[model samples]
Target: MKTRLFRMGLAVLSLAAGFTLAGVVGPAMAQQNVTLALPAQSLLFAPAYIAAERGYFREAGIEPKIVYVAGPGVLTAVLGKSADFAMISGGIQIAAAVRNQKLVAIANTQDRFTTDIVVRKPVADKLGAVPPGDALARIRALKGLTIGIDAVNGLPHSFLRYLARKAGMNPETDFTITALQPQAMVAAMKSGTIEAMAFSPPFSLTAVNDGGALWITGPDVDLPEMKTFPYNVVLVRPDYCQAEAAACRGFTTAIGKAVALMRSDPAASLAALGKTFDRMEPEALRQSFAIFAKYTRTDLGLTEDMYRNAVAFDRAGGVIPETAAVPPASELYAPSLGR
Candidate 1:
């Protein structure tokens, strides 16, 4: 791991000194300015960063700007026309669709459900002998602990609830979930304010560096329900996608290219993203990218089965009410939006 991290770090440093890997690879077209809103700076959105850094967005004739906001604000950014696109959890989009909101998921970047349940090192030491592969056992051990999440109904919170329920515990009463930013969660864990946290890296990696241990890593846990689910997806207003078809398609294509890049060349992909995560430790960034690249979608298409699985996950987590009128995947997802 250390060797790979060092190699990737050097590769990225090379990019700083005029390493040209064809920033412009596609047809010449008019560049359109586009804004994208993201909920957090998790490695789950590595595709977006890589696309911008490696000039995939430029190749697709797009000048992209990424804006960070707290949970649910990403939805607001798209809805209010502040951003042309937003990368958000599939569960949030599904919940909005059930309410007849005008939203469409153009492409799924991170296709698998991912987050890490990290506990302080001391806490982990107490839960002895739990097999790393046994996701249920890992989750069962988290019962009655104060777990930190970034949002109230965001992916981390929903995922934690889902895991808790699957562990045969009452998600409502078995544990206390406190909402805090990723950085704050780390501080809380260090201060003993929270026992554990559930979030995506490099926050999880940061916690681990600060005397925390992984309880359940979403990518490593091979759960049937999480497979094929849309964890990080590019969302747009259907009307905007129709009116500005070129921009939408170009943006989607850029993301798809980034996804392909991540799979085809790890060092180059890491280099492309290194600029975005300059402050992160090289090792932690490499590990985080590894987790993200493992399950990023190659096709970028949003299938009916995928949306159905996401809906099921949200429903199980109580993010979507059982009585809500859920539309068919075809109504919510724009299969033609992506290249």
Candidate 2:
């Protein structure tokens, strides 16, 4: 009887040891830390803000730290590996790709263009009635006005150039395109320095609220050949996606969930996003969020169509030189990265 008991005890101890080893060798289920870079606080990233606020990133085993790097430095942040991902305009993303930057878009937040052009009410009054929805007439009216943009060669500047060309004016000679910070643009417009400004919300909306008139709005007026484009997207290094596949996949998944929530439950999502955009007026924030959600891609997938339109847009804006070789869209996005 003692020998039998000893044998049984040995078997039980051996089984317990095997289980412990398995636990040690198994895959981890803990949260992964990631850094995301942003240009500034704008409604263009509403989905990302929603994802973070609703614990969607946490649900995907990610702890995201948002780093604000102004200007075009968000690209540098990702390139230097200080950030795991960056939210930026597709035009800049494509421009980076043209210069041989190894960045691939894993998720797109907004599929339509988001730039807005607002003229000081006084300037609009001078233009007289151009009839709403007549984008060409509106563009023609700005021929002699000085327009302020956040950055030269950015979406706003390029868009103005494209519009100027379409309106039968030389982008270089017909009007002036000036670069200024958003606040500075506001002050300049108030002081009659800049006659007009082009930007994304709520700067555009704020200008409109403060006695400016909307000449073009992203969600309202449809421009030629800009039906489906990538306005805002999440970019990652191709190698990072390969090595840390889970992190990239998780980030995309979080964005997907956020987009779905924004579409399915607008009131709740807006209520949550309002907290993130606490500085903006509640109604203005709601309007911006609604416009964003309306244009957000449903699957959060980055398609080749989006890329092609972006290239065309960039070319139209003169951001992409005619002589430069454009890389294939396949090289710019990871289709498998999204949920």
Candidate 3:
């Protein structure tokens, strides 16, 4: 009877050990696949690249795929179910929310102001040599002058409006805003088609290097409405977030890790970003990284004040209907995963 009892105990112990090993290895083998959509040319998308290249996503038990899309196609792609998530301008997200699209902002990538108003060198030089300190005055002087913007209702327009108001001018009455893509802004400026424009780097850097005058940078004006503004944000379709909460959490955690890495070692982050850019130039890459660092944050969380401000601006701009309820910051974000 004693021998039989010993053999039975050994069998039970062996079964328990087998189950423990399976439990340990199960999650590692069941990693989920996730896709992130990014714009083709913005430094704001660097963290995503960093996360993917440095294995942060993998470490978090996620298989992340990064996809590049055109400027206008990003929101549509997410809304149409072609992509899982995207990093886009805050204005776009606000606009979508106003339209009652089921999208949620998951992370704040570029959390500060970085756009600038640049003018043609000759035009600015002819206007009595624009001093860097006198940029607001220069912008105000160009009353009725045409200015180019990337979109009619996005960052460039919102920021320009804020700048105009701060400079004691109305965007509607003081200047004529023209819509132009980033790639074409320089050519338009060179040909004198547009006198000045609000742009983000490396486009801003490119324009300056090509002899465009920097008139007013976003931070210089100190616009009340734009203090500590949120720029690029990570967004996911509402359905995706609901259906794959665990996977989404893992993805956010991975991005947060990437942001931490970037903050700790920008040079290493830039090197990681270089892999994403085709024909990358080291100097340009470094400059681009510097510009991006000024705007992005590794916190990976949205603040209530920032969200409220963004919602108010959108509602006033008619991007979101006044009757539309502004969701709480908690509803619009999920940051616990990062912690």
Candidate 4:
């Protein structure tokens, strides 16, 4: 018995040192099922889509099915168990908690705001915004002009509201706001009807290539409120996470690998993205990669500051009640089982 104990102890130590106490790669296990919802078809979820495209899901022994949901609906999908996981903004996660819905973010895909305010070239040139050289000045020039947004409660509109506040202008009082789809936004910009529009990738890229000026990029402009916000998160139910800890860990690990592939090999990453964004031109896809690469996260962790900001934004917008204003970020996260 003493010898058996000693051998067992040695085996554990060896296993910890990177030796799989192996039997061969045993017979394949049934593919674990996972359903993940994304907020949209944006390039922001590139890493995850890449994982699915590159067989990382297969390699991790998970069969992942991705669905596209818009806005807060992504969270609702996960909360109702219609999806096992979701990729959404941190704000929605915080807002749900205030309402007493128990969803948790297992991985954060971005720590900064990747969206920007893009203005039409003709509008910029007329306003002497030719390089949009000074953001504050150009912003001031937008007074009484028309601006477009994707939706009333979307990232574009939200950020635009924040920006107007910075210029000491009320979004409602200072200018006319119109909600238009990205395609329409582009058309409006070129047609000289809307002076500016704001949103995240794929669309942001389209805005620039179509003769709109990237007047201000969120983090790049050094906005303190925009930094460290965990704009994109990989979320799951706390109960679901606990029940399937191993699977959650494997899912995140596979995502980490996909993020790495995106950084280390642009060609391969672009190819992987092609499988999902097939409608985009090759140049357009490359343009999108250039715009969003900096925001992709290879490691996933939640942060308190991100939750604080998300909750504050939602509350200010009346999206969440004051009773749930302070959603605890720490309590809302259940890290994956140890690798």
- For model 4, residues 1-339, the per-residue Cα lDDT tens digits are 999999999988988665343434532445698998976678888878888999887777788999876666788898888999888777667766777876877887677777778888777777762334455555677888788876665666666666666667777778788877667887888788888887776777688888988887766755555667768788888777678876787688888888888778999989989978887777878977866777766666566676677766665545556565454657776554414
Top lDDT hit = 1
lDDT per residue for candidate 3 within 1-339, as digits (tens), equals 999999999999999998899888665656788677765556667788888898877778788777866554677778887888888766667766656665778778766667788888887877785566764676676778899887676667777775565567777878888887776887788788888888777677677777897777765654444555557788887667668887777788878888887778987898788777655456766887787776567676577766776776565545566788766666666554333
TM-score of each: 0.87, 0.86, 0.78, 0.80
- Which parts of model 2 are misplaced by more than 4 Å? 1-29
TM-score of candidate 3 relative to the true fold: 0.78
User: What residue pairs clash in candidate 2, if any at all?
Assistant: none
Query: Among all windows of ten consecutive residues in candidate 1, which has the lowest summed lDDT?
Result: 18-27
How many residue pairs clash in all the candidates, one count each?
Answer: 0, 0, 0, 1
Error of 2 at 149 (Å): 1.8
Order the candidates by lDDT, highest first — what do you get? 1, 2, 4, 3
Better of 2 and 4 by lDDT: 2
Error of 1 at 196 (Å): 0.4
Clashing residue pairs, backbone N/CA/C < 3 A, model 3: none
Candidate 4 at residue 171, lDDT? Answer: 71
